[model samples]
Target: MIVVGAGPVGLTAALLLARRGHDVQVLERRTLPSELPRAVHLDAEAQRVLVDAGVDFAALSSPGAGLRLLDADHRVLAEFPREPGAAGMFHQPDLEEQLRAALARAGGQLTTGVGVVAVRPVRGGAQVVTDRSGDPVLAADLVLGCDGAGSTVARAVRPRYRELARPDRWYVVDLLAPAPLPVWPGVHQVCDPVRAATFMPVVGLRYRAEFRVTDQPLDLPAELARFGAQDCTVVREAEYEYGARVARRWRTGRVLLCGDAAHLTPPFIGQGLGLGLRDAHQLAWRVDAVLAGAHDALLDGFGRERAAHARALVRLAAFTGWLMTAGGVRAARVRSGLARLLPSTLLAAGTPPLRPGPWVRRPRVGRGHGVGRLVPDVRVRGRRLDDLLGPGWALLVCSTEVPDLPELPGGARARVLHRGALPDLGPALRDRWVLVRPDRVVAAVGPRAQR
Candidate 1:
């Protein structure tokens, strides 16, 4: 399989596929990690996806302060604290490095400094035409478009982008702070009529600031002066247009899009990279299954599932942008008041559970409530379920009676759970057997297998 763009999403998808014994090839146009400012807030869900992809995220990250809403004068409107063991600040470039290392360890090949000319379906599979000399035209059963917003694979399928909201432009500033500023550690969303800005603190004394563009030729030092962070070395400065958009279709034929190729969420919700990581998580499993002789429609189901999930978050981000950038003093006050009323859970990184479909079995009234949701961090004999889930379907038999051998998909071994074991699962698995897909999502919940 060929994966385009060696960014975190591409590398991650490549790694996951490689771990499942697939020969994955990654293509990247840039020789170096991107200098463009990227996502800093990685929720716990995204972190779990990375860990499953073989990345040690904790060592590479620092604890992050939670989200805060502030008025034009910088007075606190509300604070949504990070949940226990929730993610914090992280550097995108560092994550790329880790992904590259993990990909190499998993035997995935990454070719940098190569430009992809085009991606198209040719016969039974897809092909990636690149500018590389040794292997310019590579064809595989699958093609993944992870190249950012301007994806060639996406262009081959659906060229039009569905704009979810009015695009907003901002002057982005990245700096290396001389010292840690604990006083302003959390992400501060400044809702000002004059300037709708975002102030952020990163790990290792790095800082980022964004000011909504009002006029041309912005003064960097002057902008930083207002934030009391002018005495710092500037890293990169650029004008970035943030948008809420998703591809018309994530898949068309053998080629599939992941990450920014599939959708682009406004940074208001800090889900830009997190959403992409989720793509890597769900896509790898389906791709592996398809390669193992699963139906072509499986990939289609993946496209439908991810598109719906991504669109929901994109809408939320667009609404957040409107709430934080409403004009006028009276509008700002109204925004602050709304922020005060906003439930902390609304802004949390956790997402809505997957809707029922091919990948997620629709739950019955109450017995299969855990279906379509990611299994909790339940442990068996002190071993994490994460470690137990292999490259295939796993069964967590919660019902009584431990069958010597249970008939399941792939003839999987069923591990029966007794009361007091895996307390994290609690009553979710009280009287039903939970079938977990390779992605760690609960696929189905029903009675224990008798055979």
Candidate 2:
């Protein structure tokens, strides 16, 4: 299989597919990822996905803490915790570089400076036209496009699918601050009627500022001046708008769309890359299954499942963007009133809880919940969740007394956690045995003796 685009989503897909024993190639148009910070927020769910993909989180630099919502004057509106198992912030390139390094270690090949111009479906495969050193054609059983919104794969297949376009244009200016701002180590959002600004700390003494400037092109110097900074260098600038759309068909014969090639949404909830990561994980497994001679239906399930998820994220992002960028006097009044009336708890409630255990359950042995479902990640004795299972079936026995069930087969691993002792277990599993799947959903809840 050949994957197009060497961005985070594409590189992750390549690594996973390669680990599943496929010969995968990742193509990138750029020589390397931008040094500038982009998409700094990484949520709890995304971190779990990275762990599941065998990424060494410890190898990368630690991310900044929590998320903060503020008003135009930087007055705190809401604050959310940023635990290791919860959401945090990191520079996009740093994370992407780590992913790329992992992909290289997993035997995935990356071809930089390769620009794919067209993709055409062929008999039982796909053909790609590209310009690396020169115009050349490459053939593969499947072509996975992870390119950004202006995807060459999307353009090539545009005539074969329906497209949705948004109405308003939004501009974003990314600036690098030489010194750290006198703020907490978290994300800050300043909402105003005419403009909005989001500040996220990427690393020590350096920060990323995302400005949502509408109506006119942003003057980087002028904008920086308004923020009390002098002579700041502009790193990146782009125009974007929120929209909800997906390829009518993910797989046309053998050519498929993944990541941004398949869908694009605003970063309101910071799910833009998160959803793409989900696509990589889900599609990698199904593609591997198909290659291993599993039912073709599994391959078809990719589009069916991901399309629904993509649409939901797009709508949610659009709604969130509307709330943050609301205009008019009435809108401003409503926004201010909301800021004054809404409790911090209510705002925090909007953020998902950190449920890590249910996420690691095996689907075949234990009941599988949908992706992003909350699950506990408690350890049994000295065995950590990362060690108990090896990408297969696992049983989590949380009981004071051993159950009467038969021993697990060679392919399955089991863990017995004494009641009221496992960390992060809370007071819920005091003396009950819970059966968990690899996907981390509780399959069965019963007395300890039931096993």
Candidate 3:
């Protein structure tokens, strides 16, 4: 197996694949890991992926308080409080280091300073051609493009692409502050049409600020004059394009696209990193299944599922962006009023669950309800459910008696819990069993599994 790019997504894909006994090789153009962190923070769902990969999130990330939507005057419009398992601000460099360590532990090979010039489909699998001075060529059973938005592999695959938002420049400013931070460690989305920006406290006293591009390059000192020039020192100033896009197809034969190569969501939701992590997690098991002699069609669902998920998140980010900065004065008033009137739960994460796809089993009793929703971490007898489930399907048998359970295509274990043990199981499990996927998403709910 060959994976392109060594970002979090690529390294993670290599780690998961190698863990399954696959000989995975990762190719990267860069000579070394990045010194600066790009991604600001990760939520509980994304944090779960790292934990499953053997990372200790509690030690790596600071405790986060979730996100807050503020008005022009900094008055709170809405806030989404982080749940107990939610992650705080995580330094990207630290995460990359952890990913690299995990890959090494899994025995995955990572070659830096070597770039893949092209990936061409051969008779059975694909051939990866690199741009090293020697111009080495390697054969692989499968190829994954974990590269960024301008992925060479994605272009080679020639999948139809759609742009959700026009690329707009945004200025980012990182700062190092002395002890006694000026602001609390929380994300503040400033919703001001004059100058929309995102403020986050990175790591300790380190802070990051992002603002939509302005006519004149923002003078960091002047823009942040309120902070008092002596309080913080500027680390770096950079500009990046912020937009949303997704590929129509994720896989073309043995060549596949994941991470930024597959979709790009606005930073409004901070799901950019999480989505990539999700792509890796979703594809790893299926790739294992296909290699295990499952039907080739089993790999057909990757594109559809990821596209749906990316589209939903893109829409949510765009909607939130509008509520934050799009509207004019009159619209802003209405938005503020609506924000105040709306229930706080609506602002919480995991609002609308991803629609079930080929990989998901539609619920028989709830009419597809809870089918694709991610299951919150629940502990039983002082052990986390995921820790107990390990990396396999979980059969939460709740029906009075096990009605001939269906064989899991990828193997599963039967775990029966007494009634009321997990109240979050809802009424569905009271009379039926629930099939949870390895990624901890509810797969199906019925008296008996269908297949």
Candidate 1 lDDT, 1-451, residue by residue in tens:
9999998899999999999899999989998778555777788778888889888888878876688888878899889878765766787888888889888988999988899998878766888888878778888888999998888788787846788988888988888888776556678888888888888887787889999898656677887877778888888888889878877687877888999988888888789998999998998877876787767777887777788888889998888788777668789768867888877766774777777886587655556667777887666778766776665676666445443433443334444444334554646555556677777788777653344
| Tens-place lDDT digits, model 2, residues 263-312 | 87777667777778877876775576566665445556567666766776
Q: Higher lDDT: candidate 2 or 3? A: 3
What lDDT score is found at residue 38 in candidate 2? 54
Cα lDDT tens digits, model 3, 35-128, are 7778867777777777777777677778777778777777888777777556568778888898899899989999999888888977657989
The weakest ten consecutive residues by lDDT in model 3 span: 411-420
CA lDDT, candidate 1, residue 373: 72
Q: How many backbone clashes does candidate 3 have?
A: 0
Q: Which 10-residue span in candidate 1 carries the lowest summed lDDT? A: 403-412
Please state the error at residue 42 of candidate 3 in Å: 1.2
